[model samples]
Target: MTTTLAWIDYLIMLIYLAFVLGIGFALKKFMKTSEDFFLSGRSIPAWVAGLAFISANLGAQEVIGMAASGAKYGIATSHFYWLGAIPAMVFVGIFMMPFYYGSRAHSVPEYLRLRFDEKTRGLNAITFAAMTVLSSGISMLAMAKLIVVLHIFDAPFASLGLSSEWIFHASIVLSAVIVLGYVYLGGLTSAIYNEVLQFFLIVAGFLPLVLLGLKNVGGWDGLRHSLPTGFTHAWVGMSQASTNPLGVEVFGLAMGLGFVLSFGYWCTDFLVVQRAMAADSMTSARRTPLIAAIPKMFFPFLVIMPGLIAIALPAVQEAAAQPGKAATATSWPSKGLIPAEAEKDPKTGEMVPKYLRQAGSDEPLLDANGQKQYAYDYNLAIPNMLLHYFPTGMLGLGLTALLASFMSGMAGNITAFNTVGTYDIYKAYINRSGTDRHYIWIGQLATLFGTIVSIAAAYAAAQFNNIMDALQLVFGFVNAPLFATFLLGMFWKRTTGHGAFFGLLSGTAAAAIFQSLTLPAGAGPGIKGGWLANLHTFPSEMAQNFWLAIFAWTTCFLVTIAVSLFTKAREDKDLVGLVYSLTEKPREDHLSWYKRPLALGIVVLIMTAALNLIFY
Candidate 1:
């Protein structure tokens, strides 16, 4: 499909860029101290903080990844939201926010230092700092790649006599510059404000696409009738790993994704929690993630439905067939018939799917000789829909929204990196004591360092298969087992610092071992790259992740318990407010019904359960 950007679209995009930069520069007066720069001086309201909480996660990679997974796995991909995210977000808001807020720690790692020892804090800090930078780089890479693939800047670059290669490099650098300008000037406050803006832009940009796509697909009833069997249901085929599109059994989905990965990302991951921590009050902080969860429950419709609609488009089918020339259209479709399977082309001996290819451009992959190549590129799902459905001005707005999401993601990581590096690593270890001005300067420097490193890492991420796979690998390596240490330390008062530290070490090692042993050979460097012998083959990557997390959490839970029994424990008084049992719970009987955390949590759970049943 051919689409061109109009001058009006360029105007809209330019206005957006200026407005974002204006927000960043305007907030510079607020950056008076490290606390203000890092935590917004702990005064952000619950609703704004809640929007930022979700927007921090609404990156370019996440948008593309959600749509890609939706196309590849159907409604089963909603597992990432409903089962994998909502409960964990609720848990963080209701049970974990007390200690996080009451302790007054600048970062999550700092909390570890107060609860455990310097060693536990050090491990988490280094790991988290590294993860943030890497994730930032990935966001940068995804944006650059999208620009190249969608030709978002091609016309302007061509007018300026610039090559595609320059466009690629310029796009990455420009994104970095834009994100750094805001984040460095206003710190976390600027990032949070822009995230709220980005969230609205995303909704405004994509909601139309969903509405149009749904209309084209004949609405909800049409969608159910048009999609493949088992595609619409969330849990009907989850009894076995092989039966479900997610390729994980009910046990694995519940424990691994619903519990381990969900809790790991929401409760412990600083990316989202940083927003919650900046809330004006304990009540607001607790409500931050809860409010974020409300919209999250419905996000799959905006991000994933477009992918489903793309499959039904004639252009997508035509591109997959690669009609005429060296590539002949093999088994072209008839009206009202959606091809569900593929057969090898007799002449070319290539496996051409009868339906839409899952990945890449609607156009078939071209070889060096300009011959059509048969490869499934599911990542092109959303981009294809934009090109096909959206007009010039609307397309520009959608692309601008996409760019905004990328910048928001990058800013989120940069802010997290600066805070963690300054407070957790630099002040705690390098300087011991620094003035408020000195630390704020250090945070600015950290932002610069993070931006440069992320630029480098974005180039590295270009070598990965895709963003979604790269993230899954990171989770298996770090987050799967990391949650175990936090779970024990926060709730189990007897858990020693040594037990917590060693248990974390053992759990991470177990995850690596499980992944390395099961990962197949020649799976590439980042995605399931393994050094040891391949011990087993998993039904899918998600299945492997489920089992890997299960093992990691189980190992850490057992090890922490066993090691704590043998080691010296801290006194209960020292653990007051940090440990759940020792901390006094706030009485909510006097509070309004809707304002109570437990009441809100129960409502969220009930709504989530109802969604699962409806889809099931």
Candidate 2:
């Protein structure tokens, strides 16, 4: 699993890094104002913002998690893209962007403050800031681990008389420096441009891998035969929780993922919304997500193919039956094979993972932790596929793409963190009337603070083997409930600040309570929950997350409506642009039918539905 990169690969990555820094430096002169730094001066074109919107999301969650789930759950992973992303992206660009963009607010939390109470905005701001840092850490962990696993920096480190063990730490430091260097200089504008770069790089880097992988696996038809039952199909076997690899029924998938978690992340998550908010006008803001959704509809093939191919390819000439169970480390074709627990080494009297062939075999199969030998490691599907297929020159491009994917996440999260920290938290609470120049200084400082916090968070991400699982769990807790609040506040003017705030608290509590009481079927009681009691068990972690979101959203929705009835409401004049009923609809009569948000939104939905059926 450890592959050393060549000088050519190193050179390609270096060039990409330099260009990344160059873009930041080039944009530095324009970032004098806080608006320019945090919101891109709202001067970006719709097309650029759209690309940045998608690229901002192509971090560890997209590249690593998508591929991991594809390997683990087959084409069902497409649900994360098609079912989870497209509709919400279209909705945000169409329905939500007007409130966010026209409100003249600095951030999402600021928008909340405009529509609701300060307390509600404060809670969201704090939680969102925390989530961004944690998310940034996850991206950092992916990059550092990739460098360590691939031994990408081994040559350079050794030449500098550094111990190989320092690779992980050094890599983390280097990754932080790269992201911080650009983000500190250009802020949101720099991150957005870099995201556009990452988007292109990811497509360019992964397209070859997908083409070569499918070629090796006998194309689509061959891949179907090579995969296990239901692995090639997305919608089939979804009727029953036990019938599919995803371990959830149709209802759970639709409501939990498609509705709750999907809307929670795409519609409300600041990580994505910040991109649209940076658009030049209401039209561009509305178009940002719609444009992103066009390419998003087909991204599954680019990202998910590697995982399917990774699992389908056999170490020997003949393929074997796909096996169940996940490993904590990088696995290549081994996900299709069963692995036993590590055995004790007779000589050292210490437990260590071992590769066995027969009754008398002694092959050293231990990973870096001496515990990741024979089992399936779903996390490395993308990394493994890249190594398996790419040659020297192409390998550098692939590695750069992978690193860029990670940077998109770190940069996006850090940028969002700085804005929220500076405006939502500091401006609102700490320093009520800071000068614009002072706030810009604070934002740059926040960037440094976020990177340092993310470094700590990256270490925390190592506890989870499945990166996507870790990601969804975070969203389920922070986002799922928040969406309920936003839905009611924007659509129902009767929803009071007290109601929204209390409903949010209750919803978060409900998520925590549900998690503590339920456990996935095969998982032991740990962070996967069931600490309080195993009152209910789920088919899988993904299933649990979806249901958790359902409960959270439901609780918040009901509680907010009920509480609003008992609380005082604000004046209609103040609520004009904030609430949907009071707010005038965005006009697109001057534009052609095809250019209208609704028309494009409907088309996107129709196309997404077709994809689900086609892959079913």
Candidate 3:
């Protein structure tokens, strides 16, 4: 099929890029000190920070991966949002912000030092710094892949007679340059400002696609009727791993995702909490994640719906057939798999490739052993829909929105990486004290280093099955057990630094062991075999991810408790503001009920529950 892009679409994308660049340059004057550059001088308003909070997480993986899941798992994919995000966001805004903001630590690893000890801080700092770079590389890779797959820059490249490899290289360098230009100048403030802008752009670009696609699919009722059994309901199959689309039971979903994974990401992942930490006041800081939770609750509609609709498309249905499956009216040959000697089309009289000539095209894409590839490349669901449904200018807008999302994700990771590098690692280890100007200079250098490493990672991310799967794998390795360490250090006074550090190590080992034991037959790269025997297999990737999180969290919790009993605890006086029991509660403001965190949290919870029921 041909990809379309009118002049107007190109113009719109150009204008959007120029607008964001202007905002970045405009904020350059605000970077006078390391604090201003790293944390926006702690002067950002809650609403702006709130939007950025969600936007920071809205990378290419989020948009394309979530939609991919929607196509593959149906409405059940909403669990990633409602069960895996909202509750934890609410918990952070209402309960965890005080320690983060009140303690005034520059980074999460610094918080680990203040609460535990330098040893604990060292482990988190190294792990987090590495994870940020790796994750940044994944974003870079995913965006470059999308550009090639969707042919976003195809027209310009074709006019210049460039090959697809040229398209991939150019996409990577262009994105890296744009992100480095803005983020290097204005630092975290620029990233946060651009993120808010990105949020609007994404909404503008995708909202129409969702509306038009839903109309084509006959709306909610049509989606329900057209999809397979258990595709529409979120809660029905969750009772047991065998029944649910995710292959995990209600207990695993609720505890593993709703508690462990969600808390680790929303509460402890500095990539997000860093945005909230920049809020202007205690109240704003407390309210930031809560406000973000509201928009977050509704995001599945914007990102996931395209995939749900794509599966209903006649072309996609035709392309989704397995190797031995019988042909049906809806089935067609998969794209990019045509053979040399193909038959002519009856209607158009054009030479159709052999692989795409029939409904159950016998010449399917296969491996060396002749095994069929995936039923469908679900990652193409949203891009395919965008090409089919959107007009010229609108299509440009959608592509620009996609580009903006990728940039924001890269910027978020880079900013987090630099802060941790400068404060938690450099300042803590390499230098005992430094001038404000010196640290700012170090931060700029760190950004350059991060960009270089991320470019390397982008190449590495290609080996994974999909962006979402790659991300979940990273989370299992690092973020899964992190919450247990933080939870004990924050709430339990007896949790010694030795215990916290060892527990973190123990939990990570458990994840590795469990993951190795349950590595599926065709597990992707980074998932090695032979560490532990494969005794059991998971029903789906999502189930494996959830259970991996559960095992890690439980192991950390138990280990920390046991180790703390044998180790000496820190004094209460030193734990002020860091430990919940030792810290004083914030003075209540005379603000109305709606302005209170409790009231806003309750409202968000109610909305989340309503969405779950609606989808269920």
lDDT of 1 by residue, 275-313 (tens): 999999998899899989998999989887776676655
Winning candidate number (lDDT):
2
Candidate 2, after superposition: displacement of residue 17 in Å?
0.6
Q: Please give the lDDT score for candidate 3.
A: 0.83
Query: What overall lDDT goes with each candidate model?
Result: 0.83, 0.85, 0.83
Residue-pair clashes per candidate: 5, 0, 2
Candidates in descending TM-score order: 2, 1, 3
Clashing pairs in 3: 318-331, 318-332
Could you tell me how far off, in angstroms, the CA of residue 202 lies in candidate 2 after the best superposition? 0.7
Looking at candidate 1, what is the lDDT of residue 92?
A: 92
On TM-score, the candidate that comes out on top is 2
Report the number of backbone clashes for model 1: 5
RMSD of each predicted structure: 5.4, 5.4, 5.8
Worst 10 residues of 2 by lDDT: 316-325
